[model samples]
Target: MAHPKEVAGFKLGKLLIEGKTKQVFDLPEETGHCILINKDRITAGDGVKAHDMEGKAAISNQTNAKVFEILKAAGIPTAFVKIASPVAFISKKCDMVPIEWVTRRLATGSFLKRNPGVPEGYRFTPPKQETFFKDDANHDPQWSEEQIVSAKFTFNGLVIGQDEVDYMRNVTILVFEILEKAWGLRDCALIDMKIEFGVDADGKILLADVIDSDSWRLWPSGDKRLMVDKQVYRNLSTVTAADLDTVKRNFAWVKDQLDHLRPKVHHKVVIIMGSAADVEHCQKIGKAAKKFGLDVDMRVTSAHKATEETLHIMKQYEDTHGALVFIAVAGRSNGLGPVLSGNTSYPVINCPPPSSNLVQDIWSSLSLPSGLGCATVIYPDSAAVMAAQIIGVQDYIVWARIRFNQLEMAASLRVADKKVRNLSIE
Candidate 1:
């Protein structure tokens, strides 16, 4: 099919590719971007069964835009640029990876069909991942990680080696888990999701393709009967006008719920040092805390020497709005954490400055009196992580940053493991 010459004022150069539900067109003037236009058509069983649901294009574009916005804010790299129109969006042009990465939190649908005898709704801890080669005629057959690395398929001059495969696998799980937690906040369970990747002109691999109603299985209120995803459309035995409308309504509900998913809550972390000597240690905690967008305020006050001044500092933060976390940095009979924890209605973390007698220093912070609920961490980074976890309970943005860091750590471990494996004598 010939592509449109112009769409939403952006001139379409050529028809790049077409899928069952979307079409990609190269931008004539934009060298590195393309326009992806969603179609009203929906399909199942590898396009053997299909329907043209009204208003689906606009609904899908809206959902995809919102989902990608959240993901990009979470620091996940994606090809999505911005929404171009009601039915289309702008994206980075890339040589697409011919693989679909699927992560599952619960066993159902094709998973149960492929692995017979496995009961439906069997939960998978850490989530199970499967890779499928992108071949529609072949029903997107499952491919193992070993097979993926062995294939060594190159896209945009970048080879898909074991390292790359490991990175993608880790990222696929992160994307699913992050979105899963986001949905969980809205009382919806993200059962499973399939995502694709692509290599850009600069040879950087990124999450690509559209992620809307058709990409995942979402069960509202943890009940499969109340699913509000493309599965509802696929489950229909016989298509009818009213059935399509019901499916459309389900899709619209998902889009509506997403509007409330991105949190607007403010979070702050106050790092209080017992003496000027602990300023360096407290600053380290503040540095790490700022990475997750938590407002960090460093102060100098001795809980033992100036009790009134210390209590005055606590009163200020207690009066501030939003979620707050306090980090107490002190050594030699540390009392800041206990004092702040006892006085204020906020979480307090104890991170003592390193000294010659490390064990003795830790004891001061660790061995706290009963009823004082202050937690202790040895490293500054650990203290920051604990603070982020506390703040993330109310802030989705911070929650995403925490998850993103976890993904990076997991990827690094995989690379280290691969290095050790290669060093072994053959």
Candidate 2:
């Protein structure tokens, strides 16, 4: 149901191909971009049952646009460009990957079928990742990493391998985790979701395809009775007009909630160094904090030499702001962390400048008087991470940043472990 203007924007060249859910159009003027027209039709069980609810194309377009927009903002690599119309959007032209990457938080659906004896609501700690061959004729059988690596599949002129599979899994989990935290603030649990990837002309695999209400089972407050996703449509005994309308309403509700789900950017992190000598150390923390989307302010003030000035600085920061954490940087006989911790109600972390007597410097921070709680860190980045965690307790974006950091480390370990195991072959 594309509007005349929308069709005019995409149909200038030729219709590339049409799938069950969308139509791919080739754009001769743009070498690396194409237009994707989302269809209103939806199906479950590998197209066994199908329905074409009215106005679904626009609803799905809205949802996919919001999902892709947020993913791009979160620094996730994707193939989304911009929404072209109410039912269409422009995206990077890529050879689509024939695999579906799935991530799950709860043991339900097909998971229980495969792993019997597992409880329905049993949670996955880091979320379970799975891959399946996208074969509608064969019911999309699950595939292991070994199978994916060994199978012969080429996308965007790049062949699949162990590294490719590993990267896809990593990106899939990242997308899930970031969006999961986003939804968590809306009092919804992202039970499970799947996404497809595509290799661009430059051979970089990116998150692609549509992610709307059809992508995941979103249980509000972790209750299945309040589920709002394609599952609601799947659960219907027999599709009818009323049931289709209910599904349409649920999809709209899910799309409407996305606008308010992202965490607010009001939280701020301030780093105060006692002297100019510690400015370098404070900057390191501030830089790393900014990488994780933390709004950081660096200031130099001494709690011992300029106690009044330091208090003024803290007071100025908290004059109107409430969600803020402080990191104090002072070297020997550190009084900055203690003074800030004692005076302020906000969290204060000690990231003292390095010294020859390192143990003593750390002890100065660790050994605080009763009721004074200023956390200590040896390195600058860790100090930033600690402060993020403290603020993340209440800020969802900060929490997601910390989670992405963990995933980055996990990714490194995974690659290293694979290399270590294949040392004999090398």
Cand. 1 Cα-lDDT: 0.90
- Model 1 lDDT tens row, 211-231: 999999999999999999989
Q: Which candidate ranks first by lDDT, i.e. highest?
A: 1
Give the TM-score (vs. native) of candidate 2: 0.86
On residues 1-426, what C-alpha lDDT tens digit does candidate 2 reach at each position?
A: 442323645544567677888888877777888888888888888888899888999999999999887887666778999998888898898888889999999999999999999999999998999999988889999999888888868876778887778778888998898889889888899999999999999988888888998889999999999998998888887999999998999999988999987777578899898888877888899999987778888898888899999999999988767688999888888899999999999999998888888877677788899999888888989988888888777776677667767766776887798789888852
Where does model 2 exceed 4 Å of error? 1-14, 115-119, 276-280, 354-367, 409-426
Cα RMSD, each candidate: 3.2, 3.4
The candidate 1 region of ten consecutive residues with least summed lDDT is: 260-269
Q: Judged by TM-score, which candidate is best?
A: 1
Steric clash pairs (candidate 1): none
TM-score for all models, in order of appearance: 0.87, 0.86
